[model samples]
Target: MEHCELPRRPGRLDRLRQALPRLFPFLGWWPQVNRRTFKADLWAGLTGAVIVLPQGVAFAAIAGLPPEYGLYAAMVPVVVAALFGSSFHLISGPTTTASLVIFANVSQLAAPGTAEYLHLVLALTLLAGVVKLGLGLARLGGMVNFVSHSVVTGFMAGAAILIATSQLGHFFGLALPRGGSFLETWGALLGQLSAANPWVVAVGAATLACAVVIRRINPRAPALLLAMVAGSLLSLALDGPAHGIALVGALPASLPPLSLPWFDLDTLRTLVPGAVAVAMLGLAEAVSIARAVATRSGQAIDNSQEFIGQGLANIVGSFFSAYATSGSFTRTGVNYDAGGKTPLAAVFSSGFLAAILLLVAPLTAYLPIASMAGVILLVAAGLISVPAIRHIVRTDRGEAGVLAATFLATLFVELQFAIYAGVILSLLLYLRRTSHPHFITLAPDPASPHRALVNIRRSPQAECPQLKILRLDGSIFFGAVNHIAEELHRIVAQSPEQCHILILGSGINFIDAGGCHMLFHEAGAMKLSGREIFFCSLKSEVMELLRRGGCLARIGAGNVFKDKSTAISGIVARLDPERCACCHLRVFDECRARPGGEDVE
Candidate 1:
C-alpha cells in the first residue's frame, strides 16, 4: 500500500523552538550531550589548559603586556567563543599572530610594560571587538574570501620571521631597544652582542633543544609545556637571576579583575587604525581555521556567528584585563586531535585555565624570559609553511608574484598595507585575465559525421559567404566590454560580405549596462547596413538583462535562437538564394541542397 505524507503546519511554539537554536547556537548541540562526549571533552579540556599555560605567557610578552593578561585572555574570551561560535574545535586565546600585530601597531605611542601601554591595549581590544561585532551584525563575513591564500601565506611567513627576530634579544641576553624596525632591531642586536649573557643563552638553548627533541620523538607531545618546565627547572637549579638572566616574575593568582578601558578621544583616535587591522585579521584567521578544522571533524560552521563570538570574546575580555584575543590555530588543532567532542571542550579549557593559574601562579617565578623567547621562536618557525610556499612557487607564477610582494611588504613595510597590496594585486591580475576573453571563430567540423561546430583553427571547414559564426567565452562586464566590441568590429572588418553575425551566447554569464549599450549600438549599426545580428543559446539571465536594458527589443526577439541547428536553418532561409547558389563552400546543408552548390552532407 502506498502512503501519502501530509505537510505538517508548525504552530507559533514550534517556530519559536526552531528559532531558539539559531539565536543561542549552543542549544543545537546541548540536547545531544552524552557521557562519552563529556569524558572526551574533560580530557581535551585538561590538555588544552596545560598547553595554554606557557603559550599565554609567551604571547602576552609579545604583546608588551604583563604575563597574567595572557592567561586572562585565554580564559574569558575562550569560554565566550566556545559558547557562541559555530566551530566545535576552535579555541580562542592569545595567539602569536594577534600578539605580534598588537605590539607592532601600539608600541610607537607608548613604552612597553607601562601603565599607559596597558590602557591603550585595552582600548584597542574594545575597539577591535566593536568593529568585529558590527561586521558580523551586517553579515559581511564573506569579506574574508577576498583575502587570497597567497597573501595569508606570505604575511604569516613574514610575521613568523619578525617574531623570531624580536625574541633574539631575550634569547641572547642582549638589552636591545624595542619598537624598532626589522633592520633597526637587527642592527641594535648586533651592536649589543658583546653584552650578551652566557647563562641566558644556555637557558634558551636548553628550552629550544627540549622542544625539538620532544616534537621529533612524538609529534603529539606537549613540547612547549615540557620545554617550559625543563627550562624553569634548569633556571632554578642555576639560580638564573643571580647570573643576570631576566625572569617573568610571579603572576597574580585568582579570577580576572574587572576594569574599564580608557575612553580618551586622542587615545581612541590613535588606536582606531590598529583596531581595524586586528578586527579584520582576527576574523579572517578565525573563519579560515574554523572552516579548515570543520573539514576534518565534519561539522558545519557559520562565519557570521563565529565573527560575533570572537567579537564578544574580545569585548568582554577587555574588561577582564585581556588584550585582543583571536582563534589560535595551534591550540585548535591540538584540541581536535585530542578528541574534543564539542564546544564544551573549549569552554572547559577556559575555565580550567583560570583555576590552574590560581594554583600555579607563583611557580612562574622560576620561568626565565629566555625560555619564553625559545617558545616564541618555535612558534615563529612553525608559521613558515614550507609546503605551501613551494607549491605556490612551483605551480602558479601569478600567485608566486603575489606571495613575493606580500612577503616583502610584510617584512619591510606597515603590515596592514601588505594585506591590501596582495588583495589589490590579485584582483588586478584577475581582471587583466578576464578582460581579454577568448573570441574564437567556429566552423563545421569535417571530422565528425554530424554537422557539429568546431574552432576553425582546429578544423578543415569553409566559412559561408553570407554568415559569420563567432563564440564568446566570458562575462560582458564593463571591463570586458571594450575588448568584446573591438573583437566584434574586427570580425566585420575581416568578412564584410558576411553581414549577418551569429554569436554563441552560452559562454556569456553576465551582461551589464555597458555591455547592453555596446550591443544596442552594434545592432543598430548592423540594421542600418542592411544586415542582422543573432544570438544562439543565450542563457535566461543574459536574456533578462538584455530585455530589461531594451537591447532585446531593438535586436528583435525572432533573431535569438535556442539552438545552433535552428539558428543555422533560420539564417539560411534569409540568405540570398543567388549567393547560396553561387557559393561552392557547401558549409551548410541548405547551401549544398541549392542548384549550383555541391550536395554534400
Candidate 2:
C-alpha cells in the first residue's frame, strides 16, 4: 500500500500577508463591502445616530464639557475609527469611563467648561492619540492583556456604581453636593433626600419604567430616545401652573468648527497624566470590544490596526473640539444587533449623527435633565456584569482577590492609581508563582508497568545505593536558583550512600548567572564528598550554561551521556564492585557479567 504525505501548513509569509493590515487597518474589513452590506450599514448608521443623540449630551455633562463637545466626539472619532480600524462594526465615541477619568484628572488643574479647561482637554486628546499611534507602530498591542479580565470586570462594576451615584442629584432634582468620593456622594444624597423635587422624580421614574419595559419587550425599539421624547412631552404638559421640572434648555444649532488645541507648556504638563490614563483605558476598551465582536463573527481582528484606528480617531477628533473617545460597549452591541455588516456602518453613523444634530438641536430644550439622568442610571446598571463577578469569586481565589482590591481601590482612590494597583498586583502574583519551580525525584516502577515509568512527588522505591537520579521541570532562572539549590542539598544529605547524582536535564529551558553559580557550588560539594555529578539527556542550552560557568570541567565530560540506557550501563559499571559482589539481589545485567557476579534466580 502506498502512503500519502500530508501537506505542510502555510509559512510565515502567508501569515504576514494576513496581518499586514497593521499598517493600513481599513483594508482589514473593507473587503466585506457589497451592495447588500452597504444598505445594511446605512440603516445601522441611522440607528446609531439616533441613539447617540442623548448619549453625547449626557457624556459631555459627565466630562464637565459643554454638550456640543460630546456630539463632536461622537462624529469625527466614529468616522476615523471605522475607516482605519480592524473591526467591521466597532463604533468609537465618548464613553462614560473616559469621561469620568477626564474629569477626575483635569478638574483639579482648571475649572470645568472654561477656555483653559477646554484647551487642556484638547491637548490631552492629542497626547493620547500620539501615544496610541506609537504603540500601534511598535506592535505593542499585546501589552493590553496585562490588564486582566478580572480587573476590568471589577473596575467596570465600580465605575457603574459611581456613575449611578453621581446621577442621584439629577434623578431626583436635589441640590446635592458634587465632586467628591463615592461614599461622600452617597452621604450627601442621603442627607438631602428631603430636598428632592417630586415632579422631577416622577419624570425620571416614568422614563426609567418606559425604557425598561421597551427593552424587555422589544430590544430593537429606540427605547431610550422614546423615553426622552415621552419625558419631554410630559414636562411640557405639566408646565402650566405648578409643575417645577427643569430641562436642558435650548442648544446651539451648528456643525463643530475647526479648532486647534492650546499649546501652552503648563496646559500640556497638566494634561499629560490624564492623556496617558485615557490612552491606556481607551485602547484597552477598543481592542477588547473589537476582539470580542470579531470572535462572534468568525472574523480575524488585527489589534495593531485597531490601535492605529483609535489613535487616528482621537487625533482627528481633537481638532473637531472633541474630548477623548473610545469604543462604546453599548453602542457597538447596538450596531451589531442593528445588522451592521461593514465599517461603512460606523462612517454612516457619524454622517447621520451630524445631520440629525441640525434638526434635533432645538428639541434639546424640552428634554429634561432628570430624564437624561435616568438613562445614565440604566447605563450604570448595564456596566455591572454580575455573572462574571460571581464566576470569578467561585472559581479562582487569586483572581477574586484582584477583583475585590480593584473594585474598592477604584471607589476610593483615583482611576489611574486603581489601574496601576491592579496591574502591579497581577505582575507580583505571576512572578511569585514562577519563582519556585517544581523539583521531583523519579524512580523506575517495577510492578508490571510500562518501560521506565516513574512515580512523581512521592515514591517508596529505594534508590540505587550508589546512584541518585533527579528530575527538574522548570527554567533555572535567577529567581529560582536558591530554591533549586536547597532541594538538591537536602536530597544529597538524606541519601549519603547515593554518592553519584545524575540529573535528567531535558526539562530545563533556561539558566541565569545565579543558577550557574548554584550548579558550580553543588559540583564542588559533590567532589569533596568523593562523589560525582552527571547529566543525562542534557539540552544544548543547559550545557552552554555549565560550560560558561566552568562547572562542566568539574563534572567531567565522560560522565555526561546523551542516552538514558548508555548512562545507566556506564553508572552500573562504575558502581562499588565489592558491594555488588556481596549483594544478594542483582538489579542490572552488568552485575551478572562480573567475574564473581551471581543471580538469586
Q: Where does candidate 1 stray beyond 4 Å?
A: 1-6, 28-67, 94-127, 187-217, 233-247, 260-278, 288-301, 328-345, 457-462, 529-531, 576-579, 582-584, 598-601
Q: Name the candidate that leads on TM-score.
A: 1
Which pairs clash inside model 2? none
lDDT of 2: 0.79
**What are the per-residue Cα lDDT tens digits for candidate 2 across 1-601?**
9999899898999888877775566775678688888887887787677667767887998899998899899888898888888788788999877998988887888899998888888888999999888888788887867778777777767767876887788888887775678888888888989888999998988888887888789876666667767877778887811566777766667788898986778777767877888998899778766765664577777788778889988998899998899988767866776678888889899888777677776766677878777766785676677888999999989889888998898899876566667777878777776777766777655553433626545555645667787878888888988888888888888988888888888788888788888888888887888988888887898888888888778778888898666787888888888777777545445557643575544
lDDT of 1 by residue, 449-547 (tens): 767898988775788888999899998989998998888888898899997999999899889999999999989988998889999998899999999
- Kindly give the number of clashing pairs for every candidate: 0, 0
In the order shown, the candidates' Cα RMSDs to the true structure are 4.3, 5.5
Q: Supply candidate 2's per-residue lDDT for 71.
A: 88
